[model samples]
Target: MSFPRSATRSALALAGAGVLVLAWGGSAVAAQQGSTTVEPAGAAFSATLDGEATFETGPITVTCAVSASDPGDGNNLVPDEPDNHNPEGAVGGPINAPNFDDCEADVPLVDVEVEVADAVWDMSMQDGESAVGTMHVPAAGIVVTTSGVASCTATVSPDADVDIEGTWTNGDPVSSLAFDTTAPIEVEGGVGCPDDTEAGFTAAYEVENADDADTPITVGP
Candidate 1:
């Protein structure tokens, strides 16, 4: 199925708003039984659950970033857009230009799917406890479009979740990570990402030097 940029942006924006609320001492909900959490880890990603299991929809952040270094900078490259037959949308066609001259140009990164366990009342951690939710990623990476802001989506039940995306320049760095909450959501049974995975939860990102000419992308927590 195709992803709706507006819908995803709304969902993620709402979630990110919830995170801000909690950060500012606002109340947030947790699932009664199942819950899931997702976060970024540098270039890799990870997820977890508490009570029941959940599935990820994959990263779905729509990127609108093109670099001056990118051969397609002036050509135009749109990512995750069905209309754009070429995902990289570089210039001169692949035959004329085989590789992305600005392959490292800062692009958006989003996780479309995240699987978690069903939330259970008595079998899981007490409500509002850290155990009830999972910590996904500490930070994420982002690409700025001609427009200044970027957005993404993340879903979580009874569990509280946060995922970050960073934006940086060669000298100065600034980052943003959209958040999501599936609180007050009901799960069939109580399950989450397995315990083994929980211990190794990761926080990945697609790093970019927004102001640099030859910036190489890096991924990490």
Candidate 2:
């Protein structure tokens, strides 16, 4: 999916409106026992980068100054089955493709470009006191292209799907979805890029109801 760019936006301008929802809109029925649900189901959301997005592979670092989760698709939180441990929701993908802008490499004169894959990769959201969602790019993973003084290709391909971990605050859907992981987002590179797989990615986003900005998504069971 092409990430629809609406001029350049700062993550601050649209904070408190970020969430990854199941692609297949679900019923708002109360969650079943033992099921972790991202509540207020059947709603879409808006998300802005809580801060700058960063990707690092050893000494090389790339940062995006802005990013947003595209709006639409009636995305919402379904009950249980997101299996935060496994990171697989019932079906294909989060509601929108996240878009990034003003990305630059920390290395002088080197430029950075990132692209999320186009295939359907399942996502899993789980509630553990707070909330956690896991996502994985298709086999292609997320491609980071570096150009300018030098050019290179790097891919952050997780061996398994539904594995990128994102966390939400306890009962605070308005808080940022924390995407910093204990483990690096493992990467493989070529053409002057690092040969080892020690890449890391981190971003924070706040989620709000697309239909009702004042309403925050909640977790149940």
Top-lDDT structure, candidate number: 2
Off by over 4 Å in 1: 1-200, 215-221
Off by over 4 Å in 2: 1-33, 73-93, 158-162, 170-173, 182-191
Top candidate when judged by TM-score against the true structure: 2
Worst 10 residues of 2 by lDDT: 14-23
> If scored against the real structure, what TM-score would every candidate get?
0.17, 0.68
Residues 1-221, candidate 1, lDDT per residue (tens digit)? Answer: 11111111211111121110001001233333322211111111111111211111222122212211121222112112232122221111110111101111112332222222222111001122222222221121111111112222222222443321112111112221111322222112112211111111111122233334243322111
Give residue 208's lDDT in candidate 2 (0 to 100). Answer: 70
The lDDT for every candidate, in the order shown, is 0.19, 0.48
Q: Over the stretch 1-221, how does candidate 2's per-residue lDDT look in tens digits?
A: 43232332211110112110001011121221235555555555566787777755444455677766645543333322433223332222455556667765533444445666655544455555546656544554455554443344545554544356676663354745677652323433333333444445677777776667666765544
